[model samples]
Target chain A: MTKKPLILVTNDDGISAPGIRTLISVMKTIGDVVVVAPDSAQSGMGHAITLNSTLYAEEVFMNDGPQKEFTCSGTPADCVKIAIREILDRKPDLCVSGINHGSNASINVIYSGTMSAAIEAGIEGIPAIGFSLLDYSWNANFEACKSYVKTITENVLKNGIPNGIVLNVNLPNIPETDIKGIKVCRQAKANWVEEFDKRKTPQGKDYYWLTGKFVNLDGGEDTDEWALENSYVSIVPTQFDLTAHHFIKDLNTWNLND
Target chain B: MTKKPLILVTNDDGISAPGIRTLISVMKTIGDVVVVAPDSAQSGMGHAITLNSTLYAEEVFMNDGPQKEFTCSGTPADCVKIAIREILDRKPDLCVSGINHGSNASINVIYSGTMSAAIEAGIEGIPAIGFSLLDYSWNANFEACKSYVKTITENVLKNGIPNGIVLNVNLPNIPETDIKGIKVCRQAKANWVEEFDKRKTPQGKDYYWLTGKFVNLDGGEDTDEWALENSYVSIVPTQFDLTAHHFIKDLNTWNLND
Candidate 1:
């Protein structure tokens, strides 16, 4: 008998989110699973880790295929920290995060809990992948995404990711058949142009809800935004190093020490 | 009389950190300062923003100086968002963050509240910069950095930063006389080799504290790490476009559509 691969599962949408639940169901077919995830939704919480308060991760559920689950009071990145440092018996063979309710394509990867979890695992030297749906609706169809998720996870398990790199996978909301196979792409040049909805409080205090339109400046058909538009599952091999290395030589000209 | 340059101030160490105090003091000499920062410390909070909770910015202090201040209940990025949308009478001439207690050089910038606030402002079309001291101690010597900070800020104010570009300035901890001038540099290839310090809880459970030693892999004297080592204030021109444009072409070769 072969040993099942150890899989660490997490998500930004809390432990009970339908996205993680679906992901967990898929993982059971491939490995021995351990889940450590936020107790509540943590969408748009890019790369946050807990330091101020004591993290609380309780083993809340068991008996579903011998997998243990912990509901954690931390960000998705924090969940990965606690799992690797305190909870897991050994390092995971793979770390998979999300089937997120919203898109994490283009520039959104920088501000995404889904992708951050994957990046955290990559930092720990574990191969990881983050999956997200183009649809933001809670009831969006995830059934269409299962096979591709399984395939990508399997491919990662077979061929390890390069050092300092992880995978950022975004799926379109179309049906599985309409979905083309995964296309490895780069993060698109995009950003949210915030249009703050300024309103007054009932007590006459002014407040604002941070809202915006995501603008894609990159028109390249090879970009993630373009891949998803053409119904392909986009896979961006992402890294944790945020350094803009190309600008280093130009900066050396400044007389900083004088 | 010439109108004072409109300066927006924020920090990762909350509105009340000594770091921001030093930053606020310096900015007052150069501009009409408007401070909107988190009410509590937000160290190590990487690019997180408030969404689940409503944000509130209160007039926390009325100072004797020309600067006005507000304490916000949000992350460093949120402070920038709130300031740009509501607090400022017009777009700020320059946005400055930190005098951060620890280093934000190399890989730390990705996980820095100080730098992220500046990055957030830069993303929103504001000319911004994040400053840091190499020393982590609260009593870190900032006096030596005063003139350099003012010079850099003034040059930036006089010659606006390019659209979508900001600055990441790291000051070496040393005496004023020993300090070298500033250098334009690039982020070094570096990482934190995290060592998890695990411990047992009172209830017989286990928990862990995340700690690490940074490993600098870039041997180039032209990098930020090298700049700091040479006692120069490292100024890396940074941008918020997270697109990996180089990787897009390779992704198009994948057999996704077939």
Candidate 2:
């Protein structure tokens, strides 16, 4: 019999959120699962790491599960760092983060705590994937994404991800039968037009709540936004290397040294 | 006289840091400057935005500079967002972040609050550059890089940065006379080997502090790490889009749909 792969599971919406719980359940079926996730919600955290603070990671037995779980008092990236460097006995076969309560598609990936965990793992030279649902509510139905998630996870385990790359998978908020299969796509050129909801405190001081409308500026049919809009699960092969190689030549032309 | 370009200046080391004061001084020579920076140190904040908290921007009179300044109670990314959305009367011609108290070269960009502010501006369609010094002390001699900073800032203004790309510029900590010129380069493949400083609290509870030694694994002479080591200022054209376009075809071959 083939040995079950050791899978490291994590999420940004804290250890007890339904999204991670669903991810944990799926990972348990395929591996010797070890979960090290944030103790509280860390949505929109991006790639933040703890530097100026102390971190606490305590083992906890939540539900009747075979997985060994710990709740970390740090950002998602910190959780991945601590897990790989201190928690796990050996490097796991794969690292997966999130069945996130909202979409981490397109520009959202830039501000996503979910994808940040996966990116942290990728930086550590581990194959990783971050999964998200289009719905944002805590009670979003993550069950609809199980089989698709499993298929993608198994494929990653079998084929192995390219070095320096991690997967950003987003499922449309639809039933299983309506998910028009998974489409390999690119991150669409999209952004949030922030509308700060300005309000005053009791002492007449102004404060702002960041609220924004996501706008998909790209019309490419091969984009993740188009895939999700068409009821298909989108898989954008994301990278952490932020270098714009094509423009490096143009930058060299500048009279910088002169 | 041609209208001076409206320049937005910000940093992660709080509004009072010498690094940003130096940046503000340099920017003042090139344009009408507006300084909107974090109220306190927010290093290693990455691309995090203020989503869960209320944002406060208070006008402050710091040093004797013509630059309009505000101290923001948010991360570096939030400073950029609120500057563009609420503070600035018009979209600034350019956004410059940092003269960061440390090197944001190579993989360090992934966790830099300095770069995040510049990247946030880039995402908002503003030409941006993030500047960093190799020194990591509060009193690091930022004066040595002033002329070079002016040179690079002028070059960027003259030749507008390509759409969707921001410059990540790092200067070696050397006397200005000994500086070996500037080089446009790629981000080096490098990472930190984290050593969690595990300890017990006074209450006997276990806690940890994250510490690491950077290891540059790449041998390429054309990387930022190489340039910095060779006493050259490095300018890496950075991008916000995380798509791994080269691997899309390979990912399509996976049995994801099947």
Candidate 3:
């Protein structure tokens, strides 16, 4: 019999969140699961890693699942690093992060701790995927997410992701029956038009809270944002190489040497 | 005479760090300058923003450069957001981050707080560049970096960076005379091979310090790692779009829907 794939699971939402808990249950049906996720919520952490401080990871029993779990005192990227180097006995066949509480599509990917964890695994040469639901609530329904998540994860295990590439999968927050089929698409051109909520402390010192409305500027019908808005699951094949290969020729024409 | 360009300067290193001081001085020679940098060092912060916490920015006098400076209690990305939305009188013409005390070359860009600030500005439709030196020292010499910094900044003002893109520029840590001309290159495939320095706390609890040796897996001479290694300053035109456009066609062939 073929050996069950070793899958490393993680999320930016602390491990106990329903998003990850639902994710954990889905993975248990497919493989030998090992979870090393942040001990607390690390939302908006991006690709941040702990450098100047000490890191602690403690094994814990969230429940009586066959999967072993550890709570890590670092960002999502740190959890992946510690899991690969210190915790796992061997390389994981697949690394899946999230089932995150919010969207990680378009410009949101740059600020996503969920995508960062998956990207971290991709950097380490593992085939990885980061999954997110459009719902941002703490009690958002993840019951609709399981079948889609399982399908994608199984497909990934069957057809491996290419080197320097990972998947950013964002699910629409709708009933499972209402969901359309999955669509592979590009990241949309979008940005948060930040409006700082300026307020004062009790002592009258000025401070601000970061707030914004996401503006989707891309008119492309073939974008992740469009797919999600149309109730289809979006799978944007994400890459770690940030290079704008098309711009290099134009930049070389500049008079830098002269 | 043309009006001076409004330039916003920032760094992941704190406002008082020599790196930003030099960056500020160089920017002043080209434009009217404003500095909004971290109050404390925020290295390795990646693209993180201050979403979960309050942000504070206070006007501070750092030396006698012709730049108005604010020290912000936020990450590098936060510094840019606050600078543009809360502090600046109008939208700045350019945003330059770092003269970073270390290299943000190759895969380091994924974890760079310095680059994140520049990227933040780019997302907001401002032309941006992130500069870094190969030397990782509190007292790395900024003298050799000034002329190159000035040249690059001038070029960006003259030739605006395309929308949805930013520049990741890394300088060789050599003398000014030893430096070759700038080379526009792609980011090399590289990553850290992490080694956890496992240790026990005073109370006998286990902990670890994250450390790693950077491994350049790519031998391509057209990469940022190659340019920096050959003593040329490297400028990688980077994009925020993480979509793997090449692999989308292949992903669509999968039986995800079936």
Candidate 4:
């Protein structure tokens, strides 16, 4: 028999969140599981790491699931770093992050802790995926996502991901039956139109809460936004490279040496 | 007479850091300058935004410079968001972030608050550039970089950056005479090999300092790493779209729908 794959599980919503708990239950049926996750919710952390401060991680018992777990005091990216460097006995075959509480589609991916963990794992050369439910509620039902998650995870394990690339999977909140299947897509051209809600402190000082409205600037039917809106799971293959290679020749033409 | 270009300035290093001070000076020579930066150091903050807490920004007098300055209680990305939304009287002609204390070349761009600020500005359709010096010290000499910064900033203003693209410029930490000319390049493949330094706290609980050695994996001469190593200022045209377009076809071939 083939050896079971070693799977590393993590999330941005802390180790004890129901999202991660559901994720852990799903992973256990597939492989030998180990979890290293933030001790508290690290939403909107992007690709942050704990550089200026020290990190604290300790093994914690939170579930009856067979997966070994450790709670970490750092960003989602840091959890992956420490897991690879300190916790895991050997390299994991697959590293999966989240059953995250909300959407990480389009421009939201740039500010997501869930995707950051998956991205960090990808940088370390592990096949990685980040799963998210469209619902942001604490009681968001993840049961409808289980079979679909299993199929995607199984496909990833069967056929390895390419270098420098990882999968970003976002599921619609509708029932599994209503879901229109998975669609391979590109990230939509979208952004949050920020509106600062200015308020006064008790001592007459001014403070602001960051708020925004999601705007889909791209009308493309082949985008992640379109997939999510039409009740389909979106699988956008994301890469770590930020370079705009096509524009290099144009930039080089500028008269800079003078 | 044409109006002087409006320039928005910010950095990962706090408002009072010598790096941003030098950046402010260079920008003032080019346009009508306005500075809004974090009140404290926000190194390694990545693309993080303030969502869970309140933000406080206050205008303050930092020096005898004529530019208006506001010290903000948020990350570098937040500074740009708040500036565009609440601070600036008009949309800036150009947005510049950092003469950062260290390099944001290659994979470092993914973890850079300096680049994040510039990227944030670029997302708002502002021409933007993030400048960094390789020297990671508070008092690193920035005089050698002044002329280059001016030239690059001028080029961006004269010839606007293409939509969805921003510049990530890293300078060699050498004397002016020793420096070669600037080279437009691609981000090299590089990553930090993390080594967690485990130690005991006062009460004997274990903690760790997240530390690492940067390992440059790519040796291509066209890469930013190679340019910086040869004492040339490197400019990588960076983008926020994370999709690996080349992999989309292969991903579509996956048995995901089943």
Task: Provide the overall lDDT of each model, using Cα atoms, as 2-decimal numbers.
Answer: 0.84, 0.94, 0.94, 0.94
Tens-place lDDT digits, model 2, residues B1-258: 799999999999999999999999888889999999999999988889988999999899996677789999999999998999899999999999998999999999989999999999999899999999999999999988899899999999999998899999999999988888999999999999999999999999999999999999999999999999999999999998999999999998999876
What's model 3's overall lDDT? 0.94
Using DockQ as the measure, name the better of candidate 1 and candidate 3: 3
Per-residue alpha-carbon lDDT of model 4 for A35-62, expressed as tens digits?
Answer: 9999999998989999999999889987
lDDT by residue for model 4 over B1-258, one digit each (tens)?
Answer: 889999999999999889999999888888999999999999999899988999999999976589999999999999999999999999999999999999999999999999999999999999999999999999999999999999999888888899899999999999999989999999999899999999999999999999889999897999999999998999999999999999999888889875
Candidate 4 Cα outliers beyond 4 Å, as residue runs: none
DockQ, all models: 0.45, 0.90, 0.92, 0.92
Candidate 1 residue-wise lDDT, A163-224, digit = tens: 67788899999988898678877778777877667678999997767887899888887788
Model 3: per-residue Cα lDDT over B1-258, one tens digit each: 999999999999999889988898898889999999999999999999988999998999866865798999999999999999889999999999999999999999999999999999999999999999988999999999999999999999998899989999999999999999999999999889999999999999999999989999899999999999999999999999989999999998999999
Worst ten-residue run, lDDT, model 2 chain A? A62-71
Q: Model 4, residue A204: what's the lDDT? A: 98
**Candidate 3, A1-258: lDDT as tens digits:** 999999999999998989998988999999999999999999999899999999999999987597899999999999999999999999999999998999999999999999999999999889999999999999999998999999999999999999999999999999999999999999999999999999999999999999999999899999999999999999999999999999999999998888
Candidate 3 local lDDT, residue A28 = 92
**Consecutive 10-residue window with the lowest summed lDDT within model 4 chain B:** B249-258
Could you report the Cα RMSD, in angstroms, for every candidate shown? 2.8, 0.7, 0.7, 0.8
lDDT of 1 at B17: 73
| Candidate 1 C-alpha error for residue B117, in Å | 0.9
Q: Using lDDT, give the best candidate's number.
A: 3
